[model samples]
Target: MERIELPGFQDLRVQFDYDEDTGRIQYRKLSNKARRASSEAGHVADVGGALYRVVAVEYPSGKSRQVYAHRVIWKLMTAQEPPREIDHINGNTQDNRWANMRDGSGGANSKNRAMPKNNTSGACGVVWDKATGFWVARMGLGGVQRTLGYFENKEDAARAARSERLKNGFTERHGLPKSGLDKPQTLEDTLV
Candidate 1:
């Protein structure tokens, strides 16, 4: 069992608890008023409608430091079922509102990203080589590199690449064509 140190009500007091089931530390609040302690400890408490946890420490020279009570409480409350992965919808770590949090697999987590402007090549920005009968996609984030594969046609390769991007929460932006600019001219364009 592991114990977690949480902030206490006042001074350098702290609380401790263990998560026997997962071998993790658990910290909760105490009802009694805190007493001054030599070292820092953590504890949990309720604030408004939310639960919070904190840790406090005092140096030998009598200087003291205190942290908020929300740290441990948020983890324990939200991780009860523990999703494979947790996503913060707005991408903010501190915005732990229940509605802002979602449980999802790694793949699902990736599908929610906004595509970069320069990433124009495969499903998100990939193109297939009709001459070689190979599917190719490129990533421009750090450097340009080709992700290639063999496919029957450009569409097959494009779909596969798009599926991969979608799983990681990456969505195409600015109405970019999913299959790139090489798509065959449609009759609608001729009429226009």
Candidate 2:
């Protein structure tokens, strides 16, 4: 319930003139001291203890249009806490709303998750290689990549991956089994 000063509103690129008679702000092509260029597009105002960035501008001609800067402001105002990092829950940047947004750590925020499907590569899997000298696992989403790491062995690497997922509460799909590699999957493997 602390009031914070809104930033980046004083210097705007697009010019808007305030109408005293109407008591409403309007866009004007001319620039003046009272009518400085808007650091953002469309219009912005505070409402119900929250600031809302106008998504569209209604021109004198009565045409409505979407503005990017206004949308950015809306997100800034509505975010939980300046959004340490903004995550698009559905993976679309344009869908910026309170429900679709989440605050995340920079590392967690960069996960490039795609729609889950049966044949999705690496969905329920972790990298395993005994002879490669190091073990590595990675997950990607939205052009962002995150790596688990370089373990001494495949088993060690898998354990590390599973531990990380569990700590983060990520559901396990096809990683290592909980019992470790103590029990072989097949009778032949056990005999060997």
Candidate 3:
């Protein structure tokens, strides 16, 4: 079978009426031969919740294609493909609302992530260095992990980590939350 170029913003414009507020793509009016029209025109027949992909049928050939909703929505709104990843600001995969999405690098996207549930330390990047018996704070900058500072207290270490994260341009949401602040698991956890 021949490969087809992926449908882009201009291509989708003919088949979808995008609602940026809700991130929904509704089927638009089409003539009898339009592929998308094989279903219905009034509302997008298959669109449900925030699905990651949609099957779009071309107007003439009736060719069906799979497109990522977030990418398509970003293209429609911004008129360009994302520079890297399409990240959801609130950490919700299904919430593709226009404001929730942005173009970002892997490092930048990681900075917006919530602290992992498995993290025993209250800080996003701070870990108890058992060998040194100090609360070590570190952060990722431009894909490299850099040590921020070492502190005697977990709070101090967490603060240092937060400060470094902010100074490096990471959003506050990506910083450590309260739960990790005092979760010292090792001997160093108590040393702080």
Candidate 4:
């Protein structure tokens, strides 16, 4: 399929009214074979397993193009094209509030992600090294994976991974469980 070029800020503003505070977009008027006046725009769709708000815009040539509502809001509110990547501050993909969205690099975005479902341990990058009988701490930065260290305890390994992540600019929310709480998991925390 051909990639559709995003319409300009002015072009989008003409078609829809964006609410920055709520991250909602509404149609200003009835368009050819599409939304009615003041109707909500966009529908929730799965984008890489996370749900995101997206809208299909009909072009002059009778072709429809889909765009992320966050990107559309960024353009309409800032009068600039959205960055190549945008991070949802709280890690909620559907929350498009102005305060919750920011431009980010691929690495920064990755660092802000929630712990993967496949992770057996409760922490990110702390895994069991069966052969060595140690908890291995590792991390990836800029497409390069590096081992932090090995620990006798999982919490120690988790702490090491967390420390390396912080030192390397990972978000505090990175590796957090789906509950979104920063639970006490490190041995240092218990000691304190």
Deviation in Å, model 2, residue 86 alpha carbon: 0.9
Which scores better on TM-score, 1 or 4? 4
lDDT of each: 0.42, 0.41, 0.63, 0.78
List ranges where model 3 is wrong by over 4 Å. Answer: 1-5, 29-63, 176-192
Which one is best on lDDT?
A: 4
Any runs in candidate 1 off by more than 4 Å, and if so which? Answer: 1-81, 114-123, 127-192
TM match of model 4 to true structure: 0.86
lDDT of 4 by residue, 5-119 (tens): 5677667777788777887787664754567655678688987788888877656676768888887787777887678788998888888889989887566688788888898
| 1 or 4, greater by lDDT | 4
lDDT of 3 by residue, 80-169 (tens): 654556677765555667887887676667777667666788667789999899998988787687988888878888877877777877
Clashing pairs in 2: 12-37, 12-38, 12-39, 13-38, 112-140, 112-141, 112-142, 113-141
Count the clashes in each prediction.
31, 8, 2, 0
After the best TM-score superposition of candidate 1, give how far the Cα of residue 76 lies from its true spot, in angstroms: 4.4
Rank list by TM-score: 4, 3, 2, 1
Task: Give TM per candidate.
Answer: 0.30, 0.32, 0.67, 0.86
Error of 3 at 106 (Å): 7.0
Candidate 1 similarity to native, TM-score: 0.30
lDDT of 1 by residue, 1-192 (tens): 123343333322234343333223323344335633332235454544333444543434555455442334334444343444555444433344555556645544444333344543424546656687666643332234446456665565555555454443454321133233234434232111
lDDT by residue (tens digit), candidate 2, 73-110: 33344532254454544444433444555554464444
Candidate 3 local lDDT, residue 159? 74
